[model samples]
Target: SFRRSNVSPRFLHSNSTSHTWPFGAIAMLIDNAYDPDVSAKQFWIDKTVVKDQDCLTFMDNGYGLDLRTMHKMLSFGFSDKTTVKGVQPIGIYGNGFKSGSMRLGKDAIVFSKSKSTSCVGMLSQTYLEKIGAEQIIVPIVCFDQTKSDKHILDLMQ
Candidate 1:
């Protein structure tokens, strides 16, 4: 059975675009992560469990979750919502993060600003095992004001 859930934008992962899409922008963010000049920009690499596939996974941590959205959802959003559970197109509702992680990694790590985050959070191989899901979403870096302001982290107070 299939049901709809209104879980919006945990990450800013855009829906796939055929044309007029910025492959350039995606490349730039990846580039900036590795750039020597950008100190606020950090690179988290999971070198051990490569699986050697030609795929790159990027997660946006804190860009979309501003105060207004949080408050709106907090007020009236909770009362009228229904999240389903099953293996569907995205494969496993509501449990995507856990399901996906279980299917991917034996170990995981979450490279986040939060020091309390687990290594298992970022590494997908182990994550899949833990969550017992076919897919999972991990929020990686925060594209905050530093990236957009053009000031640079090394120069800030």
Candidate 2:
């Protein structure tokens, strides 16, 4: 956790956050977050999925790449609010933005069109690497919501 007062140089040495890892390390993090045993992709695809009309537009360009730039975006309404109903705080790690950076690639362009006008979380691995960070991001772009069920079983892996 970076304190508001002291930045980097000092923050790097702090105990709260001290683990400078390479880009390859991110792959393991993502795999650990999600499971390979009991899969849930099919359930999510069949249940929560409605139509392709649920993606909200977003510039997955890492939501901009710097602290000032990202903060500016949030201040300008890039981090929209929406409903979050997952498990009862079980596997929920409470930080999707960070997770997205690794899975989406260092420089990804994400575009979503969802049902809600205010539901978004954009992350860029390229920018995160510059700042020394990463996450298990999964920005799923629905391809014809109608193609759920067995179609997704093959896509889950």
lDDT of 2 by residue, 1-157 (tens): 8754422222212321222443333432333223232122322111122253232222221112232223322222233322235422222332333333333233433333323211223444444455654322323323333443413211110
The 10-residue segment of model 1 with minimum total lDDT is: 10-19
The total number of steric clashes, by the backbone 3 Å criterion, in model 2 comes to 16
Model 1 Cα RMSD, Å? 15.3
TM-score versus the correct structure, for each prediction: 0.24, 0.25
Steric collisions counted per model: 28, 16
lDDT of prediction 2? 0.30
- Per residue, candidate 1 scores C-alpha lDDT tens digits across 1-157 of 7875433322112211211334443443344333232222444433332666434455443322222222222221222212324312221122223223323323333333322221112334334345554433342332234344533222100
* Model 2 alpha-carbon drift over 4 Å, by segment: 1-90, 100-104, 116-121, 127-157
Model-by-model lDDT, in order?
Answer: 0.31, 0.30
- Candidate 1 lDDT at 111 equals 33
